[model samples]
Target: MPGPAPRVVFLGLDGATEAVLRPAFERGWMPNLEALWDRSATGTLWSSEPMVTPVAWTSFLTGCNPPTHGIHEFHAIDPAARTIIPNHAGRIRVPTLWDAISESGREVVSLGLPMTYPPPDVRGIVVAGSDAPGLQWAFAQCPEFGEEIFRDLPGYSHKVLWKRRPRTLDELRSVSLRNREVFRAQAGAAERADARCDWSAMMVHFHNLDGIQHRLWPYLDLDETAAHQPEWTAEVVACLRELDEAVGRLLELASRRDAAVIALSDHGFGPCRALVDVNGLLCRAGLQRRLPYGTRLSYRLSRIRDRFDRWKRRRSPEGTSRRGPRSIEGEVGCDWSRTAAFAPFGQLCGSIFLNEDLVSGSSAAGRTIGEIIDALRAAEDPDTGLPLFADAFDVAERYNLDPAAEGLPDVLAPSTDGYQAMAKWAPFSRSLLRPDPNLPATHRYDGVIAIDAPGVSPDTRLDAELPDVAPTALALLGQAVPEFMEGRILDEAFDRDEASIGTAATGGPGIRPARRPIG
Candidate 1:
């Protein structure tokens, strides 16, 4: 009889770092994860520069860098259009792991995978996560995937539970509890579908750990006077422990057969308090101009929108802001010259794309722009004293840099901890960060990684090539890793005892194969 085809399952914990999980697991906070770690070979999964969600997860899934996949930050740039496009839908140009599997006639289910706004044409169920406005519309663009399946799931909202309300001590605890339950429900639904399907690959993502870590990190000082507060330490542990229990539930649902179960996070988390407005800094650097008084700009035309929203909302119309209050316009266009950069989330640090029309007369302007970005990266703040930014890079490494790709930023900025860059059209932004003496929350870059499965090798590190995840999965499934895949297949994680899977025309370390661009 033929050997059973391997089944694969991936659980992505956004912002889960070893920093928190290590201590939490030591205290028995994550028993199931600990069990998985005990059985599996695990190591740190390092991320690319600007180590944020959209880029890291996209790289993992597509086996390509931000340039090749067309996602740098949570936002993407169309160089020709000179516009900042959000990384909604599968705008990635490379094929994802699920797409490869489906092509081979295997089934796959993807839930809450970032940048999967327009769900791709997969062989199985897909529920795109990350609330992009055009999520349903993007899915509709794909004629292959059943639009009905996309409709059944909730729209791509970043965090349903944590963002339900702002961070309050009570709200934090409640969100933690509610998040565990919600994750359980979602995982259960996916597992039920798994049972009915003949062959399957499913990815489930949880964002609560990252959310809790964001708010609770500063309060985590072990030697503090408030150390005993559950909200400080015990409460944090409880949240992680609850996530552990949810993991246990899912493990129970999966078959013990040659099924490959892997638990991973996109990147770790760290502490962030005040947002550093990079645009304000760039304005000081002579990179951005300010809006002159009495000048009309699309983004500046917000007063009219505000008035209209307020006037219509007084009637309590059916379609308006879900939470009733003074209405705010969703978006505004900008006088690009007056804006240096904008921070989208706590992660996006800066935008250094050049203005073609503005600098058309300058000699070798792109090269000069590169020099400016390099200097900004090495700069430091004078007062509070932090790196001007944590990391900065150009898209040349991975992106082909199409001449027609407009609005492509020349540089990407990730601020030092406790800082963020903001774009113009921002209402209340500071030129520099001030000491927010009262705020208690923080952001951290250290997170957790635990692997539990029979196929994994002990003491293995998969960070050598960040793109190895997809090839690693294909290896376990006994499929070949295609050539033209920029990443190396993780051979260390697999053992000699495992029978050889079929080899791709380009399988193995440091091998590139011919592959077509994904539309």
Candidate 2:
């Protein structure tokens, strides 16, 4: 009989961009990853539309487009109830890579992967990702491992670690230090768990890359030479050094298991200058209605009650772990009765729901999706005479989305470069557009993908996108690629004389829609 099937290890580096990676590699901050890149088949891995965490990572997990996966934003909006529930693992509609791998009678492991909260009961261990409410009891599908993971891994915590970005070198140092420890903790968790489990496939996600960049992009931007403060730059260097060591450790594990190693990112990252409030644009266009003072005050009171309820629950013995569907509605202060359209979710990329047409519309306010799209596309800045949006399209038409899919958007209108789009205005913002105080970093379309295995070519280019990861990973493991997968097997990446072997190449790699000329 043939030897055991080949193993595969998928490493997810969230929000990694070449802008940072090339510099880090050159600076010797991430020497391990640099060494791996020297012999790997690498190229840009473009992210899903919107290029946000929940959408892109979910695509990587499901091997499907955002519409197919039914995860377009960080929250799922209920049109009828007017509530916004946090998006979690339960929101994924299709079979994940883990689902396919486990179904093929192989063990797998998923660590620190976002959008994986409310862990799936698969054939192997699944330590929930950053999206989990808290790590206490909801950290893993196997409850036994949760406490051990928390105890063994030092400084382990989920996303949302800070209220604002660091303003000074000292503040940046504080954030960067914690980030390095968390990186070490996650790497430690994966290492410790691998010692106990028998697995053919594993995916470990390092979230610190994105968090640090989002909070400290300017100091790290390869461009802008004068902005690189020596002291502040050292903090970023320390964090990346930990990442390099973590990469080396995981690579060693892969070598021992004789596994094909693949490292990829959910999305790219860059500095953001302005904030584009999509709802403010809608309100100015007379499509959405802000609530009256009385109603607005009532919503504020409800918010206070919600916070109190959360505080009270934390004090109780039940703890923060709750295994159930998300119940809180979105806090979008809109008058549903008169609202024709509203952008209740999406960050960096705004998702618009045209009242009943997208599930949350009021019949009294009649509007066609086309009319709204035209209005958004027509929005311009008064001072600069520039368009607010890069592009606004009816999502159903663009992605060929399923008409029956719930929690999907009617339209996707992202801000142009130098601006981060939001569904609603900040509480005290006076205008639709304003400079970002936090200097927030936002996602870009070009991420990265690199594959290393015996048969694969060394340093060969392999340009692909988010959806390609799943089927390719399945193929690499000597498992059958499912028929539903839209991405190709990357047959070109492998050596000849074995073309279309166990894993057949379906078609060409997926390409995002071409970009239009910017203003």
Candidate 3:
């Protein structure tokens, strides 16, 4: 019979865009990636609706839409508790690609993939990434493996602190250098583990490119004023060059194993100029309530004090100190008792949730939702006079959402391609839209995907949605594409004879609804 099916190596580059990669490859900074692109089927990969990390990566992993996967954003709001919880791997309702592969008795190795914290019970090793509770305990399958791997490669961290701004070039250098080390270490661990383990599929995700893009986009595409800062620009280029080196190393490992290699990004990236506080708009419309004067005053003072502390630290020789992300929801002064509807902070997609209890006895829920939708659609950027929200969806009606789905937002407000919905609730003194200080670069919908394998055509254009990655990977391994997966195999990438082979496994019992109680 045929020798063991060719192994698959998937490299996930978070927030990579053709806009950036094309130019980088053309400049020869990424020679290995350019070589792969020349020989592979490549094209833009469509992302999830919101195009955020958790949602888009989950879709890529599950081969299903957000409605089917049940992960909408980074944080899910509990209507009853009036609190938001971090979204993690446990939030995924459907079986993942690794789960299916492992079920077929294939050993899998997954490293540094987002939303994989509290890692699933897979047949092989899993070291969680961004959403893990703590860096020390990010691994699930073998807890001690994390420490062992880090011992072999010191200075390994799953995440870099980005909430605070770097005050000096040295601070920025430190951040970028640490990030590079972590990424290289993670890839090194994956290479060593794959060599030692009995594995059919291995995936390694690198977030450094995305982090650098977010923090240094302005420097990367410098204006005359920013061009004066040569150090910043040079540092950004160095980080990118290091990223190319890491990609080259991974490709080398894949080739050594004779494995098919696929490289993809969850979403693209672009500069973000303004912030649109959706909750502030709702409060202005009387859809949400503001806190009492005294409470509001106290909150404002606390914010001032915090800013002062940050300022003091920046002035010190230590430069900027790393701080955990402060909750935007806590800054919102909404009075839930009188609130009919509110959008929580911290997502590009502005999701509005209705207080079901407050509206329980009223028949005006539909009318209220309609009014909110109209208001959001009418919202315009005062600076450019363009509409803030491109489209609004009643999630239940649009996505065929089950009424019982937990933490389901009643409305989803999607911004235009270049814009992002701001979740802060504080009132704007001048214009409703203002510059986003923390994040200069944000996500875009069209990410990049390139596939290279034995029968795949060279430089052929492949039209693929984000969900198709799972089925395509499974098909490449000669495994059946699960019937439950909404995505189809990307047959166009393969030769006519190779494409004709059967590769659909009957889906096991259809998707099971999440058991978590719906508010």
- Candidate maximizing TM-score: 2
lDDT of 1 by residue, 359-390 (tens): 66446566646665766686676665678577
Give the TM-score (vs. native) of candidate 2.
0.88
Give residue 76's lDDT in candidate 2 (0 to 100).
Answer: 67
lDDT values for all models: 0.57, 0.73, 0.74
Number of colliding residue pairs in model 3 = 0
After superposing candidate 2 on the true structure, give the runs of residues whose Cα lies further than 4 Å from its correct spot. Answer: 1-5, 160-163, 291-295, 312-318, 321-330, 335-338, 357-367, 380-387, 396-405, 497-519
Which ranking of candidates, highest TM-score first?
A: 2, 3, 1
Any runs in candidate 3 off by more than 4 Å, and if so which? 1-5, 222-228, 295-331, 402-405, 425-430, 501-519
Give one clash count per candidate, in the order shown.
Answer: 47, 5, 0
For each candidate in turn, the TM-score is: 0.79, 0.88, 0.87
Give me the overall lDDT of model 3. 0.74
237-267, model 3: which lDDT tens digit per residue?
A: 7777777777788889888889889899998
After TM-score superposition, the amount by which residue 519's alpha carbon in candidate 2 deviates from its true location, in angstroms, is 22
Candidate 2 colliding pairs: 83-329, 84-329, 84-330, 355-361, 356-361
Error (Å) of candidate 3 at residue 35 is 1.5
